[model samples]
Target chain A: MKEQLYGLITGILFGFLLQRAQVVRYDKQLGALRLCDMTIVKFMPSTILVGMLGVYLLLDLGLAKLSIKATVRKNMGSGLNIQQGRFSLQSQP
Target chain B: MKTILDKGWSPYLAGALSGIILILSVWFTGKYFGASTTFVRSAGLIEKMLNAPRISKMDYFVKKVPKIDWQWMFVVGILIGAVLASASSRIFRWKALPDMWEARFGHSRVKRGMVAFIGGVVAIFGARLAGG
Candidate 1:
């Protein structure tokens, strides 16, 4: 239930940002596909950079822990690779 | 207030806000924010309504049970937020066709709809294939 509520609020903020960025606009999408505009190009990288910085900062501050899955899952067919992060609940002292 | 009421925001601003949201999502849920899988789960849910046995028989469905889960509600929230954003910006409207599409495709609703549907299918297929 708590997770669901978090998902809802997070999605709302995401959707609002998408619309405000105008990436949801048909013109923007088509333009990006045609390589005629850089709206998405600008938006995506900025988002990713900020997200990365924020996440890493949280990690550095011991506010968040990295949950790394195994490199291979036979049932899932694909897996994530976490190269260096501590993939456990233990916090840095 | 003016920025909020504007039809559009600078991509940087919106993108940064999105990043913050992503941070929050990860911090709280220990999961990256993504919507592609939501659509896949929704298809499973819809299919489940019609044919429960077939759904159960499917290996993928067995792994990913179709139900109204967190992601589903997240999608619902997305719809609501989109509506709110459009409404707040005073850009909300009901139109069968977008002006850009009409101009390029000459207002053929059928063509637009078909192309859009196909695009959606291809996009989702790619997203799922890449394990969104």
Candidate 2:
């Protein structure tokens, strides 16, 4: 129950941010695809780096325990929960 | 009436705020904020309801959607939120199409629509192939 509330709060915060970023805008998404504006690219690495640092710090301090992510299951009955096949991480690949 | 939410916030600030929210979601719930998948699901349900064969056979379509309908509730929420925001921001320029799109496809509305439809299919299919 607590975890679900945590998730809802996070969703609200995230949604608000999405509204602000204009990322919700199709133009920015297309712009990133077109390479006309690299702001999104710049933001991606920063966000990942920040998250990684927080994770590493938590590990070092023994404040948070991390678990291996569940491996992508082959037959999850429905494809909904399954990882949508793997492919290159490159943009416009 | 149309002039409500006119002030645009700084994009950088907005981007940072977005990043913070995304990071928080990951930290708390272990999920990323993604609406495209929801869109994929909604489109699937709609096609299923209409009995569209093209939607059923494509591996790309099948993989991204849920078996049950109404799985796209979040997408509905997004649309509602956007509508509210537009109404609030006084930026609610309700056009059937945006001007930038006209620049891309010229005045042939049907051509533009077909191009958009086909482009979306290719984009999602290509993403599935390359992402997998």
Candidate 3:
């Protein structure tokens, strides 16, 4: 119950942020994808950096531990790689 | 209402806020931001209701059981939040088609709907294929 509540709060915050950033707007997304607007791109790196730094900090403080689940590894290894390869091939002229 | 609904926050400010929220979410819940899985789960749920046995046998469904989890609730929150934001912004207007769609497609509802449907299907299919 507590966890679900936490999820709900965070989800609302996330959604608010997305809306404020105009990411929910189709025009904004299309502009970002086409490289016409860099607003979304500017935000992406910051999120990645913050998340990465937080994880490392937690790990260093012994607050968090890493567990590489077998299924996740397998899915990434077979599913993601094959999909990437196919997409790259298709994108070529 | 006029003051609050006039304009949006600056992009940089919004981005900074998003970054902070992302960090907080990770720190508190230990989950990354994502909504694609919710869509998959939704599809799985409908399939389950129609043909439980067949859906259960599928490998994807086996791995990703369709239950209302945190991510699903998150998506619901997203919908609610979007509606709230739009309402506050005074930009909440009802239209079957948006200006951009009508401008590009010349006011053809069928064409617009078809294109949007196809785009959504392709996006979901690609997201699943990429293991998103």
Query: Could you say which candidate leads in TM-score?
Result: 1
For residues A1-93, what per-residue lDDT tens digits would candidate 3 score against the true structure? 766676677778777766766767777777788889776787677666666777678778876555455668997899989999999999999
Residue A25, candidate 3: alpha-carbon lDDT: 77
Better of 2 and 3 by DockQ: 3
Candidate 2 collision pairs: A85-B132, A86-B131, A86-B132, A87-B130, A87-B131, A87-B132, B4-B90, B5-B88, B5-B89, B5-B90
The best candidate in terms of lDDT: 1
lDDT of 2 by residue, A47-89 (tens): 5666666666656766545544243343343364433342233
Q: Chain A TM-score per candidate?
A: 0.66, 0.63, 0.66
lDDT per residue as tens, model 1, B15-93: 9888888888878787677778788788998999899999999999888788767788788888888888888787888
In order, what DockQ does each candidate have? 0.47, 0.16, 0.38
Give the TM-score ranking, best first: 1, 3, 2
Docking class of 1: acceptable
Ordered from best to worst lDDT, the candidate numbers read 1, 3, 2
Fraction of the true interface contacts (Cα pairs closer than 8 Å across chains) found in each model: 0.69, 0.15, 0.45
Worst 10 residues of 1 chain B by lDDT: B1-10
Evaluation by TM-score, superior candidate among 1 and 3: 1
Task: TM-score chain B for all models.
Answer: 0.89, 0.64, 0.91
TM-score of chain B of 3: 0.91
Model 1: how far residue A74 lies from native, Å: 13
Q: After superposition, how far is residue B43 of candidate 3 from its true place, in Å?
A: 0.9
Off by over 4 Å in 1: A61-93, B1-7
* Residue range with the least summed lDDT across 10 consecutive positions in model 3 chain B: B3-12
